[model samples]
Target: MSDASALRKVMAPTGVLRATINVGNPVLAGLDVEHQPFGVSVDLATLIAHRLEVELELQVVASAGEAVDVVSREEADMGFFALDPRRGESIEFTAPYVFIEGCYLVREDSPITAQEEVDRLGQRIVVGKGSAYDLYLSRTIEQAELVRAPTSPKVVAFFREHQLDIAAGVKQQLEVGIEEFGGMRLLPGHFMTIQQAMGVPKGRSPEAAAFLSAFIEEVKAQGEVARLLEKHGIKGASVAPSA
Candidate 1:
């Protein structure tokens, strides 16, 4: 086949690439999953599929842990989750695409107003099971009793229902919960720095990796990255070159 024909074949929309979405946060990278079919991570994945001439098939899953296993086991093509160094060995990360800091959610009238104050003795903190916040809390806040909820909303609910003293999550999520559930407050200080990235199964086809790299670069070059961030009202996030 001619190079042009080969390119056409590769870029043709074969079908939607199977994708998984975490049910927790709707707005990521300024793209509200509710408004736009694509969030920051989904947009990144869609761009990759489009460039490769394939369609994107998004699948919503319950937790990041499930997303990780689905992609690693080759059940799905890719996953948009907070990429960490430890998971790097099991999956291929495109690059550090975005950054979000961790924060605490508490009752609006509660005494916990700041992250430092949350560290005081007898404070109980809740976080989603197997999430970045859980890992951070495990390492840093030794004094507070840690309760693990299955999902982000549940973490907030655990605190709201008085099952726990505090809940930990991203700023956007904490804000949304404070509004949705009522009587919740987002703490001032963040838990730690977090970086989001795209991942696929280890040893997946070279075609997929090449497509991911090119798609990420294309979005950055086209300024879609910045636009998505502002569109979603998600601040403190920047789309960087893929590593």
Candidate 2:
């Protein structure tokens, strides 16, 4: 069988390229006025379907964990999310196509003026549950207290309600939501850069994963990724280096 045919079989077995879209990560995906998924992830999912010559089916979910779960269970063909050691165990990630800065936000009057300052014992940090920042900080943070929010869009709200020391999330997410939070300013430096990639469930055909990875590189080289980011007015997310 042709390589194209095999990829189609492995990636779109139901005759549709089913892609999980996470609207919880507002920088990547969000619900519009009518609450429909719209953002960078949606465009990438459509591109994958067009490349495969199949119907595009978006499986919209509220969180990255939900999106990854769909892919792991084979309920969706693939998903777009961050690449982390824990998630990599169950999914095969392609070359990252976007770099999102993860940073901490503190009240304007707060003494913490830098990223590293938040790591001290007794300081409280709130992060979205199951988010890339949450997973990373959970493992590496040894002194600071950690808290959870339902999603990235709500991290700031959680921080304010609990009167926490800092809130961690995608830089753009905090920027967009912080105006409602009076006197809140982002720390001068970021804690980490979330490497965002397209991935398929582990144990799927490697041929399909290879095709998707090559597609990411082609789009990055051809400027499609940059165009998409600009079109969405997405800031703080730089195009990632080719893998």
Candidate 3:
């Protein structure tokens, strides 16, 4: 088969490119005034579908975990996600197209003023269950206990509700939460820099994966990624360097 034919067969087996959009990650996606999914991820998915010459079907979900699950199970053909070693087991990720910061938010009265203080004994950090930060902290946190909120957008509220010591997630997300909830401050710097990328199920043909990898690099080099970020009014995230 020709390369184009192979790409379509593997990337859109159902004759439509179903892309999973995680609205929970406000930095990458969210519901607009009309409650429709719109953001950088949405734009990328649309572009991918156009390139594939297939109809675009967005499978919008409430959380990143849900997005990852659908793609890993082949329920969706592709997804955007924060690159994590744990998630890489089931998904083949292209080099990141964007880099976002993972930060810690704490109560104003709390003694913790630095990111380094967060991992100490007796500190309780609340994170969205199955989120990128949760997965990263789960593997790295040595002493502090992690409390899980139902979703990333709820992490700060859950932390306040439970009186946890800290809330952890995307810097933009935590900043928005602080404005809504009040009485919280982020640590001086980020704990981790999240690498956001496009992914397909590991079971897909290698040609499909290579196509996506090349697609990402092309978009980044051509400034489409930066343009999307600007169009969406996104802040605190940067286009990743070329792979």
Candidate achieving the largest lDDT: 3
For candidate 1, write residues 35-84 as lDDT tens digits. Answer: 44446666666666665556677776767777777877777877777867
TM-score of each: 0.81, 0.96, 0.98
Residue 61 accuracy (lDDT) in model 1: 70
Question: How would you encode candidate 3's per-residue C-alpha lDDT over 93-197 as one tens digit per residue?
Answer: 999999999999998999988888889899899999999999999999999999999999999889988989989999999999989988889899899999999
lDDT of each: 0.70, 0.89, 0.94
Say which candidate scores most in TM-score: 3
> Arrange candidates by TM-score, highest first: which order?
3, 2, 1
How many angstroms is residue 158 displaced in model 3 relative to the true structure, after the best TM-score fit? 0.1
Q: What are the clash counts of all predictions, listed in order? A: 7, 0, 0
Candidate 3 least-lDDT 10 residues = 1-10
When 1 and 3 are scored with TM-score, the better candidate is: 3
The alpha-carbon lDDT assigned to residue 171 of candidate 1 equals: 77
Off by over 4 Å in 2: none
Query: Which regions of candidate 1 are displaced past 4 Å?
Result: 1-16, 29-38, 205-207, 233-236, 240-243
Which of the two candidates, 2 or 3, achieves a greater TM-score against the reference? 3
lDDT string for model 2 (1-243, tens) is 987778899989899999999988877888899988899889988888998899998999888888888899989999998989999888999989999999989998999887778899999999998889999999989999999988777898889889999999999888876777678999887889999999998989897789889999999999999999999989778999777
TM-score of 2: 0.96
